[model samples]
Target: MKEKFNEAAFKERLEAQTSFPTLYPFKFIVPKKSLAELKALFPNRQLVFKDSSKGNYTSVSFQLMVPNSERILEVYRKAATVEGLIAL
Candidate 1:
C-alpha cells in the first residue's frame, strides 16, 4: 500500500535538521520514459542518473540551494506529479 506523506511532520524535521539557504539533495526513481519530465522540473541543475538492473527504471539525483524547508517541500510536491516517480 502507498504510504501517506505527512507534510507537517516533514516540515518540522526539515526545519530542525537543515539550515536555511542550504544545498539540499533530492532523489527519485522513475520509469525510463519519464526521465525527461523529471529533468524538466530542475532545469539547468546538475543531475546524476543511474539505471536500475533491469534498465526499466532510472534513479535521478540532484541538489539545489533552497532558502527554507517550504522550498524543499515545494520541490517534492512538484516532483510527485511525474508518473511512477518515487522520491527518496
Candidate 2:
C-alpha cells in the first residue's frame, strides 16, 4: 500500500504569502514574571498564551494585525533582557 499525500497541509504551505496579512502568529519565549510587561508592550494586539513546562520560562504566543516586524524585534530584544526570557 502507498501512503496518501497531505494535500491540505501542502496547499497551506504553498498558499502562504510573502507579505503578512492583517493577523499572524508570533511565537516567543519569555520569563513568567515579564508576561505582564509583554502584554503591555502589545496592548493593541490580541494575545494567545501557551505555558511552558520549563522552569522559569514562559512561552508566549500572540498575534499581530498589520504589525511592523522591526517593532516586534525591538520588543523581543527588550524582552530578552528580562532576567530569564529566552525567545524560542
Best by lDDT: 1
The sequence of per-residue lDDT tens digits that candidate 1 reaches over residues 1-88 is 9789999999999999988999999999999999999999888989999999999999999989999999999999999999999999
Identify the leading candidate in terms of TM-score: 1
Show the colliding residue pairs in model 2: none
lDDT tens digits, residues 1-88, model 2?
9565454564456346435434646677777788787777667766777776765666777765644444444555665656555555
Each model's lDDT comes to 0.95, 0.62
- After superposition on all C-alphas, the RMSD of every candidate to the true structure, in Å, is 0.9, 9.5
Give the range where candidate 2 is weakest over 10 consecutive residues by summed lDDT. Answer: 13-22
